[model samples]
Target: MEFIYSHNLTVDGREILLHIWDVPNSQEQAEDGSSEEKRIQWADSFVLVYSICDRASFNILPLKIQFIKAAKEGQSQEKVPIVIVGNKRDLHHQRVVSSEEGRLLALSLDCGFYEVSAAEAYHGALMVFHGLAKLIPDTKLALKKGTGIRGIVKTMSAVFARKRTDSL
Candidate 1:
């Protein structure tokens, strides 16, 4: 099951829209819009997540990271920012991946690494996003355009106009 949500977040005092998708690994669903390749392509910044308790989940990241990098083959891979996250810090007793290993992997991938427990480290989780938000360009102007009723009205009008055109 894929859990998708969008939320407005305050990162380092700046408010921004955060779109998150918790996609489980499956070959069947990996074929379309929500695929790893498409996510890497569409994302301005990426948070690639894995559970610390799941060794297989952590192991799968290298290949996903490689695929992400391969998508930017002609371009500079460093231009694409990625954050490797090890979740479930509360389950550290069952931790299969060390923080050092996560750090080293992040270093090798030329990205950032963070370990956070959604159940406990709320600030730590927020900090992870704030760290990434710092790397992104200011989206204030674009975000401003998306707010309020005017934008919604314009969107609805466009859809109606398109439908009218298609019918004729």
Candidate 2:
């Protein structure tokens, strides 16, 4: 199943409109027959979510990252802002993927990491998207100022690394 969620948020005194396209990783075809490649191409940023209790789902994250990166090849001016979220965090007893593992993965990917339970509390889920929203403006500013990839990465790392809280 796919869902398009639209929300407007103000970050740093600027109102930003976000249209989040949520798609499953299943092989099923869309009604319009849109391929995975097309979806990756259309995305400006990515929020890759996996269930904390599902190791197989966590294992596939690297492949998905590769797909996103490959789809973005040669687009030097475009910054890839990605966030890795471990859902079902309330199920601590059933957890297969450690929060540490998720944090390390996000550090390696140079993106934000969040562990949230959509079923337990809404705040956690909101934080994940809000964090991503905050990244976009910084990314665009970096590009506009000609700070390049290194600058963008540095800025993003600082934001995600410092503010990361292991709420699990």
- The 10 consecutive residues of candidate 2 with the worst lDDT sum are 159-168
- What lDDT score belongs to each candidate, Candidate 1 first? 0.71, 0.73
Alpha-carbon TM-score of each model against the true structure: 0.72, 0.75
Predicted structure 2, TM vs. truth? 0.75
> Who wins the TM-score comparison?
2
Which residue pairs show backbone clashes in model 1? Answer: none
| Model 2 lDDT per residue over 1-168, tens place | 777666666666766556566888664233343366666655567899999999988888887787677677556555578899999988999999999999999998777899999998889978987788777746553443434344434444453454533332
lDDT tens digits by residue: candidate 1, 1-168:
756456577766777776665666764245673345555544567788889999888898898778777775545545666899999998989999999889999999888899999888578778888887777667522554344444433433453343322221
lDDT of 2: 0.73
Once fitted onto the true fold, the runs of candidate 2 whose alpha carbons sit more than 4 angstroms away are 27-34, 138-168
